[model samples]
Target chain A: MPAEGGQQALNGAARRALDAVERTGRACVDSISAFGYGAALFAESFFWIFRGRSIRQPVRLTMIFEEMMQIGIVAIPIVTVLSLTIGVMLAIQGIYTLSLFGAESRVTIGIALSVTREFSPLITGILVAGRSGSALAARLGTMSINQEIDALRVMGINPVRFLVVPPLVAMMVMLPALSFLSDLVALFGAGVYVSLDLGMSLPAYSDRVIEVLTVNDLLHGLGKSMIFAVLITLVAVVNGAGVTGGAEGVGRVTTRSVVQSIAAIVITDMLFVFVVTR
Target chain B: MGVEAVNSDRSVLVEVEHLVTHYGARKILDDVSLKVYEGEVFVIMGGSGSGKSTLLRYMLALERPTSGSIRVLGRDVVRSRPSELYELRKKMGVSFQSGALFSSMSVGENIILPLKEHTDLDLKTMEIMARLKLEVVGMAGFENLMPSELSGGMLKRAALARAVVMDPKLLFGDEPSSGLDPIVAAAIDELILRLRDALGMTVVIVTHQLESAFKIADRMVVLDSGKLLVTGTVEEVRNSSNERVQQLLNRRVDEVELDPEAYLKRLTGA
Candidate 1:
C-alpha cells in the first residue's frame, strides 16, 4: 500500500511538471497569437477609418459593396424566417404556460422582452457565426495555407488592409442591420400569433409591448449584437490567419471560430444583461 | 574557392552569416552562410526537409533567424522594425511555390495588386503595366480570368508577372517549377534566365529540381540535413568528389532501377 501510494505520488508530480511545462510553452505561443490578432485588428480598423482616401479604385469599391450585399442582403430572408419561426414557438409556449395562471395577457410582454433582449440577437449572431463567420474563416484560412498571404506581403500590400478589412467592416455594419431586421420579424410573428391564435387585438398587443419595452431595451440589444459582431469577426480572422496545417486545419479553425464566437456571445450577453440591469 | 574575390564587391544583394532556425525543438537550419551578388541567379538546391525554403524565408525577412544575421539590399532583415521590413520588401519580389494568386480576384487584379497598393499609378497606367508584364511572361490576354480558371503553368506565369511588375532589384522564387509539366518548367526556367539577363535583377531560387537548377543557376548551393554541403558553379559541383554530392548528381533512372539487393551487396561487400 505504501509503495502504491509512493508510485501514485510520483505519477502526480510528473503530471504536474509536464503540465507546468506545457502551460509555460503555450503561454508564449498564446502571446504571439494575441499579438498577431491584435495587429490584424489594428490594421483592419485603420484601413476602414481611412478607406475613402486609401482605396480610390472603382473596382475595389464594387468588390466591397458586392461582398456586403452577399453578407447582409442575401442573408436577410434566412434570418427573418428563422426568427419568425422561433417567435411563433415562443409565443405558443408563453401563451400556453401563462394560461395556467389565468394571466395570458402577459404573453405579449413575455414575447417582446425575450425576443428583444436575448433571442433575436443571440439567434441572429449564431446564424451569422455559423454561416458568414465560417465562410470568412475558411476562405482566409485557405488563402493563408496556400501562401497567398505571403504573396500579399511580398507585394507590399498590407494583407489586413486587403483581405481582413473589407470583410470585417462589412460584417460589423451588416450584423447590426441583420439584428434590427430580425427583431422586426420576430415581433411581427409574435404579434400575428397573439392576434390570430389568442384573440388579442394587434393594436392592444403592440401597445402593451411598446409600453413595457423602453428604448433602452432596444439599445441594449443592439449594443450586444454589435459586440457579438466584433467578436465573431475577430475570431474568424484569428483562426483563419493561424491556419498552418492545410485544408484540415482550415476546417478545424472554422469550426472552432463558430463555436468560440457563439460561446463568447452568450458570456458577453450575461455581462451585458448585468450591466444594463444594474 | 575564391571567397575573397566574391567579398571584394560591395554590391552584395543578400548576405547571410551563421543563420540558425528552429521549429519547436527541432533545428531546421544550422549556421548557414551564403552571399548573393547583384544580377546573379543563385540557386539553393536540396532534398526535401533540408531547409532550402527556410533559408529563402530568412533572406526575404519572412521568418526571423534564431541566430546570425541576414542583410538584403543593405538592410538587416532579421532584426528590422515592421515598418522597416515593409519598406525593405518594396525593393524585393517573391513568387511562391503555389503561385499564390488571390483566388477571388481576376488574374489582372492579382498582377496589379502591388501597383495598386504601393504606387500612385492611376488605373490606366496600372492596366498598362499589367499588360506589359503579362506580355513579358507570355500570359497576355488571360488577365480577365480568375486564378481558379487558369492552369497550373499559367498561374505560375501570372504570379511571375506580378512578382516582376514592380521591377524589383531582387527576386525570390520558391520552387518555381514545381507541379508543372517538363516543358512548362523548362519554359519557366528560360523565362527566369531571360528576366535576369534583361533586368539585371538578382534572382535567388530555392528548388529541388536538379535539371532546372543546372539550366538556370550561375552559382548553386546544396544543403543536406540543415547544413551546407557544397556551393559552387554547376561545372565545379559536377566534378566534385564529395560522396553525397556525387550520389545526388549521379542519381539517374538506370542507377535507381538497379537491383537493390545486388547493389547493396556489391557496395557493402557483404
Candidate 2:
C-alpha cells in the first residue's frame, strides 16, 4: 500500500510537469498564431490598397501636390542646412585623413558620391517618416477607433480605395522627386564646402562632382527613396488599421509607424547596396 | 408569431430565426428570432449588456452567429458569398450610436461617399443628390461644414442623411436617442417616422429608451439576460404580466429594489 501510494504521487508529479509544458507550448502557439494572423491581414490589406482605383482624380492630384510641397519644398531648407554642415565636417575630416597621403582632391569625389548615393536619401527618408508617416498613422488610426471605417464599409465604399491608395500613389511618385531635390541640395552644399575649405574653384569642384556621380548613382538613390516611401506608407497604414484600443492605440500606432518605417528604410538600404554593388 | 402570414403577400425584408451568438465562453444571444417586414418600424429593447447590439450586428451580417440563421433580403447572411453579402449590404443602411462620420471629410463629402462608390453618377448629379438628402434631414446649406462643426443632434441627422443617401431599402439604427436631449431625440424619432412613411423603408432600431421605442415601434421585442422576454406591439409590452418585462417597463422602483444577484440566489436556493 505504501509503495502504491508513492507510485501514485510520482505519477501525479509527472502529469503536472507534462501539463505545465503543454500549457506553455499552447501559449507560445497562440502568440505565434496571433502574429501570423496580423501579418496576413497586413499583406492582404496591402494588396487591396494596390488594387483600388483612385476615383477623384483632381482631388488625388491636389493631395499629391500638397504632400510633395510639405515633404519636399518645405523640407528643403533643413536638408540644405544639414547637408552644408555635414559637408563642411566631411571636408574637414577628409582633408585631415587624406593629407596623410597628400590626396585632398579625393574629398570632392568622396563627399559627392556619399551624399548623392546614400546620405541624401537616408536622411530625407528619416525626416519624412517622422513627419508624414506618423501623421498618416494617427489620422487612419483615429478613423479606425471612431468607426469611420465601418461607416465607409456600410456605405458600400472601400475605405482603403478611398483613403490609402491616393496617399500611397502620391508617396511613391513624389519621394523620387523629393530625393532628386535632396541630391541637388546636398551636392550644392558639398560644392560650397569644397570651394571654401579645399581651396578648389566652385566650377571645378562642381565639374568633378558631376563626373564622379554618374546616372547610375542618381538612379540608385531614387530607387531606394521609392522603396522607402512604399515601406513608410505601408507601415503607417497597416499599423493604423491594426489599432483597436482607442486614443492610446492611435498614439502607439503612430510611434510604431515611425520606428518601423525607419527600421525598414535602413534594412532596405542595406539590401539595395547588396544588389546595386554586386 | 405568424410573421409568415403577414409577409406572404409582401416582400419580407429581414427574417431572423433561432439566431444564437457566443462571445468566447459566454452566450450573448440565445435562440432569438424576429421579423422586420417592409415599410414598418421594428424595435429591439433591452437593458445594458443584454446583447441587443450583438443581434443588430448579426442581422446586418457584421457578425456571424454561432448557430441558427439570418435571412436578410431573402438571402442567407451567414452562408452568402462575399459578393452577395456586399450586394445585400448595399441594400441596407446603418447609423451607429456615435454617428461614425469621417472627421476629415466635409458633410457634403460624407453624404456623397455612397453615391460615388455604387453609382456612375457625375459630380453634379452626386452633389445634387447629397444636397437633397441633407435638406431632407433638415441640414440644408450645411454641406461645407465638417462633422466636428455639427451638434450631437445634427451629427445624428447628418449620419441618417448619409445612411439613406443610397436609398437603401432597410435602415438599422443602434441607440438612436442615446446621448441626446429629449427634444433632439424626439426630433430624430420624428425624422425616422417620416422617413418610413415617405420612403416605405423597413427600419430596425436597437434602443434602451422606452419612450423612443414605444413611440416609434410598430412591433417590438425585448431581451432580458440574452433571452427573448416577449414580442408584441407597444401596448401589449406595456401591459405584460411577466416579472422581467414588468421590472424593465416600470424602471427604478421595481428594477433597483429587486437585485438580480439576490433574485438568482433565491431562485437557486444557494
Q: Which candidate has the top score in lDDT?
A: 1
Which candidate gets the maximum TM-score versus the true structure?
Answer: 1
By summed lDDT, the worst window of 10 consecutive residues in model 1 chain B runs over: B249-258
Q: What are the runs in model 1 whose C-alpha is more than 4 Å off?
A: A1-64, B3-10, B252-270
DockQ, all models? 0.52, 0.46
Considering just chain B, what TM-score does every model have? 0.91, 0.91
Candidate 2 C-alpha lDDT tens digits along B117-161: 788899999999999999998999999999999999889999999
RMSD of each: 5.0, 5.2
Off by over 4 Å in 2: A1-89, A275-278, B2-4, B24-26, B252-270
lDDT of 2: 0.83
Instruction: Please write out the lDDT profile of model 1 over residues B60-163, one tens digit for every residue.
Output: 77776789999989998878886687788888889998899999889999888888877888999999999999999999999999999999999889989999
